[model samples]
Target: MSTAPKTSIIPREVDALKACTQGATYEGVIMPEDLPRLAAAVVSIQREMTGKVRFFRDESNYRMVTAELHTVVSVQCQRCLSALDYQLRAEMDLAIVVSEGQLESLPKEFEGWLLDESGSADLYEAIEEELLLALPIVSYHDQADCSASGQYSTGDFEEPLAEKKNPFAVLGDLKLAGKADSTDKESE
Candidate 1:
């Protein structure tokens, strides 16, 4: 393993998991402001993401990486339609692969982590992907925190809808009448 760079932030030029020795873990912090891609998804970041990447060989002897991350940001809550602080956490397990063609060789248990021909993936981008996946598809505040929570519903549920005649009912009646006419002709 190459000597780790002396910084709390991940080094851009370094190959994260590849640089770590087997069974070793590399730790770093990522400031959201430094990542435009992530920053675009949030109103503001409350804390820097602290994460660790562990490198190891799995049972299949495939080179592997596991990244664990945690951070906080502000986003518009769907429930209250206001800015709310949200904690973001993510864990990713990946099998390092030089090319997509190598994906076929790895066990189905692991997600393939493809890199450039140089055998390196951008540490920041990989972590960002994990963080992105951690975001809620539809974020909502707790019922108590929501402004419109109690307005639409009583403690009881919605009442059963009133039954109404179908617009096609007349067509069924017409068909029955036509059938009766055909039966009379047959009888004749």
Candidate 2:
């Protein structure tokens, strides 16, 4: 195992950006093992995404990181109640900040952190946060493609019929008719 940090472009030292100076750019891939928290979060949802990160910094102490991710995710169709696979494409942008306090003490709006005092920045946390934030709150597979088998077809199913019984009808006949009706609908 390489003891070196797995992120490709993180600087070893933290540098202060002057008000009028141009910031630096860092690019790299976040190895899966390097992001345990993030990996766990995604894996818990049973999805896998991998991609590259590009971070740009400005002299005004502002930083922006963009990530392009691709993965296959498992989702249940809301309309069909069936499991399906979905192709996920996600893009995210995050602002970065450098501070000297404990990471927990930082303001809520500070999107990410630069933890070192050596004039370089490590972007592992920032990248992880950005990717997580970009995940969709809800995702579903294409409905058209999901129902080809028609066995688990949602389109053919009707809304639950009202429970009111026909007062004049015989109870046994109604029960049998209801069952036959349901089966006939399924066959259609």
Candidate 3:
């Protein structure tokens, strides 16, 4: 079956009211370079990310957006310090708010997106934030895939540690030996 060609360039910013009124839906591929914040977090992006964002007025008359994003990115495995491919998916429901005051009034079901001074919301920023929140705080390959998986420990090692000597004990021994030598010299 034929599918409609999706736009590759989504506008970075959009007028929230206009989009909501028109019920605009944008489906597209966002280039890796286009998301600087996300790029900085990962080692590299495997390919262009695909996403769909719908803007509409909710039942409560709140201008809202729902975004679904998917991508594969490369990040360093914290365990082995090697590159690992990570599958990232993010979804967000945000209500467009013009000010912080409006945020408090936002329904529990929706998060607030404070509009810029220009009275527009930044779709790119919102998308990036969602992806960032979705990322693993610390990434690691599965034990089968990780080179350093079994090398870390918080308990005693399998092999016993060498016996440790205290410096003060050695000094006490020297003092005793010196006293012996002094006594011997006085006898002489």
Candidate 4:
């Protein structure tokens, strides 16, 4: 059997971002598998990532891009050891920068968009970075449904941690001894 290739089209051509209509928007969806970095972060890529990139001229007349994206991906639940549907969402407000110095002066509200030497930003790559950033550091199912939820606690089936002594407690005792010795020496 043959399978269709998961191909995507992004605006990364020469001069793709050279000029922008102050208020133009580009919107589309990309299969999760099309984004290698993001695909590698999850167990499976079974959903389409939807997003839109809007171009606007900031007050300084610098090119600004804003993107909003969200998707549902399947990740292995850390607690249940099963596949879980994890929701990922991200919003980006970036100021296109041509020189390294521009990044230092970007407004706090805008993130620096360091375009390559060719002056074009990989549309898919940028979005993929945003998605990866939004992914949970450790994905897990809800407590009510997790196969091993609460089991990691001491009262649960897991072994309890042994009680530990405070290492600094001896310092306090040493201080008391010094004070007592000083008091006796002074009194004598």
RMSD of each: 7.9, 13.3, 3.5, 9.3
Tens digits of per-residue lDDT, candidate 1, 1-188, equal 89977657755455634554447677888877766777888777788888888878777777788889999988888766788889989998888888777988777777888877776667778788888888888887788887868665546877789999999999999999999999999999
Better of 1 and 2 by lDDT: 1
* Regions of candidate 2 where Cα sits further than 4 Å from its true position: 1-23, 44-96, 99-121, 144-188
Off by more than 4 A, model 1:
1-7, 16-24, 154-188
lDDT of each: 0.79, 0.54, 0.88, 0.76
Alpha carbon lDDT at 50, candidate 3: 88
State the TM-score for model 2.
0.44
Q: Pick the candidate with the highest TM-score.
A: 3
TM-score of 1: 0.72
Candidate 4 clash figure, as a count: 0
For lDDT, the strongest prediction is 3
Ordered by TM-score, highest first, the candidates read 3, 1, 4, 2
**Residue 112 error for model 3, in Å?**
0.5
Q: For candidate 1, what is the total of clashing residue pairs? A: 0
Tens-digit lDDT string for candidate 2 (1-188): 76976645433233433311343454444445555665554423334346655556644445555667655544556555566565556666655545545445545665545445443544555555665665566654564665544556545768898899877669888899999999999999
Poorest lDDT segment (10 consecutive residues) of candidate 2:
11-20
Write out the backbone clash pairs for model 4. Answer: none
lDDT of 2: 0.54
- In candidate 1, position 179 carries an lDDT of 100
